[model samples]
Target: MPAVTADTLTLPRLPDLPQTATAWRPVREVVRAREFLEGEGFRVRRPFPGVGLANADPFLLLDHMGAVEYGPGEAKGAPWHPHRGFETVTYMIDGALEHRDSAGGGGLITDGGTQWMTAGSGVLHSELPPQDVVARGGLFHGVQLWVNLPRAEKWTPPRYQDIAARDTTLLSSGDGGALVRLVAGDVAGFRGPGATRTPITYLHATLSPGARLDLPWPEDFTAMVYVLAGRGTVGPERRPLDEGHLAVLGRGGALTAHAATPWDVLVLGGLPLNEPVARYGPFVMNTRAEIIQAIEDHQAGRLGRTQVPHVTAADEELS
Candidate 1:
């Protein structure tokens, strides 16, 4: 399959239907993200295990860190870490995150940008605030998602997809009241820029007051929506959802949400990987044995060495 690139990709048409039936999936549960300090004292809210992992197969974890303004020298993002058997996606919403890894992969993901790093075999990396952000002080907000790789593809070569804010696919609702940004899936007629090993759909949407979106979704995929801001109603039942809450959707033909106020939400879903999962810290493998191997490899310096080079203005400006 071809990689989702800037020039090679085209917008797909929205699925046509005979009727506008709102077969929205009902919200199964509303859960809150567990707050914790991770990666050199950076605060984060995790919403997965707190809710339930079985409903979120292929997606192991989600860490939402800050929409808060940081004082000078206050930001302490993730330091050196190791990962394998899955992919880590960093989506920046407010500040800049400078990343450097053992596999010679490094970049600066600024506001509205993303860095999709596939830690297939193994890799050591760090995600931290840039010097400018730390020195000058600014708002810091972002989400880090762990995407599980099938057992057969766990050892694939690692790679990176750095997508700038401008390069992402942005689509508007029919009435132009709702804006949808496609990062890694098909939304309406638009497809995201990142290619994936597993079939998944990830969307970031913002709706004006009274705006609504009825999204066509695959029935077989497990879907959920996380509210980032404002208030909204979801599914055929129009279950009310508030900020900082995650709503798991049941099986349905489509996923829908209507904004009661200006609302911001993230939609994520993927085909389930019905396999045993053994996870330890950053490593996720099929069995405890594989997890042990990953740890041993890192301790023995097999993952690779960390390389931190200064990010130039030109490098940070890449789209």
Candidate 2:
């Protein structure tokens, strides 16, 4: 739905970095810290939490979930889980989450809410943790992204789109920055709402101190930038990312983001399933005999939801 217009920034050409010297190493820095997601008896934390896929062809995942501080009528969660062919995006900031799934779909996100699940072909979800947001302590934080489903829509079926917050579509600049284009397509000129089966693109920036932004990506798609708050400067080789960093950008142009004291980022990207993936566990098939027939259809249960648990080591594994 390309109607974006506000000082337009061009983009549309990527996939060529591969010849040597770390493939020209343009911008492949990933530095994360501040990782914490405790609840349900926090004592160094750990509860269905996850943070895997720091890098994978085209971009596979990136989960840095929770910011913690729950309490009253608690709801720490992560129950029924299962996915196929990929596509899950949840972005909140400052408490609240209660998504349900199995197709009927459920909801309850807060602070700039944006859920966007697309477990193409299969889906059985749960991400509860909201009872007035840990009983009023406030600040739970969020960020969950996993995209890669293009083998002709990888199975094709399960879908969702919760995007709230006045239907997301804001853009501002000059000091106290602002940007929220919650899904594939449009920015600067503002034109984002929800519609991402895989031509992905999502933003939710906020900068103040020193403000500066130019972000506009889609050069064949496969971008990245996840620094949720403070610390910036990212393109033109500005470098110096901070706040749970992850700035992997190689193609395209126009990405400046320079905040240093007041920042919040999320500029994602898409269009890179290039083919052959074959992941197991939660199924991301593309081969391997369709991930062994999706693990024999969830172990012959026919995967209808009701039982899909059994993943532990204290559970918090993500690759």
Candidate 3:
């Protein structure tokens, strides 16, 4: 039998994103459970740390949340690290993070802000507590997601983007309560920041109880809806999703998300880059040699390092 593609497939349109069948797989699902820290002591929830659930091709590791209270000395952050052949996006919901990169990119991202780091070829960097913040008590609330890079761009130059809240486009329902911020694509007649790298749509949405939100997606893309702070039900399948969990919609177009209560959720979906993925020790690549080169560059002291930002008192208390 001949193979079928999106161009040859026809389907009815829905108010949501167009449906595209992908190589859908559970890969793995993980729950972050709070763990007690020794020493200065901080509450932390470790997610996808075990080898069993790092990241699948296309999708990578997802750290749902972190709070400074999770570590001692208000220093609740990952120190200098290396990554290549992938991208990392840090989304801040309620707190701030001192972001410093090896590609001459550094800044402090606060609430409603985002920092997108492209570790294309390679880079050495760290996400840590700001200098001014010190060891005082503070709130560190946010999520960091890793996205796999295409083989062609895996060894390209590394870069970073600090996406501010104001730069993002917002779409609201006619009733005026339900809304979403388009972070990196077009949706609801609104255009996002247009970040280059992946064909992606990152939407931050909120809905009131008994309200519904419909999205128009590309017919050739796979999508997953993640509930951050409420209950959500998708499709006729009636797949119920609650807070701190993820709902991956399979084989469909035009997603229907109904809120059981007032809730916050992030709708993220993108076309697969369609390339082999090989990852090792903060580096991702299509071939083993590429991953090795990334490590060699970091070890040879050829990678760049940016300055860390200063953290404010208010920033520390942003949990």
Candidate 4:
């Protein structure tokens, strides 16, 4: 279980949906996460950027870190690097990660906490396991998501949002069978603490066996759900889904899902930016020329300066 949890029976509840009142989003396709080695050679499960990302406009990538227990001196993390043209949201479900950036936005994000960094223009940053984690070793699990900014906001000023786990809005299902943690955006008139420039809904939900969740989602957003643990089904069609699987949903006014076992999942959706994307290394931009410009800017030290460990060609592909 994650460190942050609440008794559902004691929380406010979401309104129940009338059986015929709303259109439930249909499951369009499903994809499983593939193993990928990331920062400092730590393993991660990546579901997009290769699978069904065309529908993930405004969202660039999703990387799921482990729930693995680490032996002493076995934990690892991302070293110093740079990013631009988007935002990075890191959520710690079961451990800790420390962040520092040239933009002066960073802190230690612990269990159930989140770090939201807008790498507008550019910023040099580093993400590392706190010395204690590296020294004592413990269970570490988390997620990092790259959210693409609209072209208009790509050049906006850089910033950060440090949302503590307690700041997240907690709500229960109409029947009290499910617990929903709202990290960003709105739900049934309840708002999450993290303020985002683009319209989006980010949620982590836990359901008891046989429990169902019907969410009021924005009709204009592209939506999907990713299973973090256990077994479940998505959509009214009851498509089979489980750990490491991502189900893309077609447009609709709401989303419906059910848990076949104790289940944990991430439900997210965002307005599509619908713009051209040119990406290379750590930069994502509108055109190939812009990508080159970003590289040149970094070389010129316009993005910022920080001592970085040597990164090989393959490692640079982590963009």
Q: Point to the candidate with the largest TM-score.
A: 4
Tens digit of per-residue lDDT, candidate 3, span 1-319? 0001122113222233333442222212333333434223434433334344344335676566643443335556676777777888877776567887765466887777778887776677777657555555456666666777777777667776767766656666444446666667676556676375777777777777876677766656656676667786765445677776665555544566778888787777777777877778687788887767767888888665433233322342352
Give the least accurate 10-residue stretch of model 1, judged by summed lDDT: 1-10
> Tell me, what's the RMSD of every candidate?
5.7, 16.3, 10.1, 6.4
Instruction: Please give the CA lDDT of all the candidate structures.
Output: 0.80, 0.61, 0.62, 0.86
Which ranges of candidate 3 are over 4 A from the true structure?
1-57, 67-72, 305-319
The residue ranges of model 1 lying beyond 4 angstroms of the native Cα positions read 1-22, 51-55, 305-319
TM-score for each model:
0.89, 0.34, 0.77, 0.93
lDDT of 3 at 219: 56
Residue-level lDDT of model 1, residues 135-205, one tens digit each, is: 98988888888899999989987777778787777776554567677888776557888777888999888
* Lowest summed lDDT window (length 10), candidate 4: 307-316
TM-score of 3: 0.77
Descending-TM-score candidate ranking: 4, 1, 3, 2
Measured with C-alpha atoms, the lDDT of residue 98 in candidate 3 is 84
Q: What's the ranking of the predictions by lDDT, best on top? A: 4, 1, 3, 2
Candidate 4 structure quality by residue, lDDT tens digits, 1-319: 6747999999999989976778989999998888899989999998988844544877888999997899999999988887889889898999899998875557898988888887878888899999989999999999898888888988877777777888788999887899999998898899887767777889899999999898888889988999999999999899989999999999888898899999999998899888898888689889998898899898888895432232221232342
Q: Report the lDDT tens digits of candidate 2 across residue range 202-231.
A: 777666678676655556776677776578
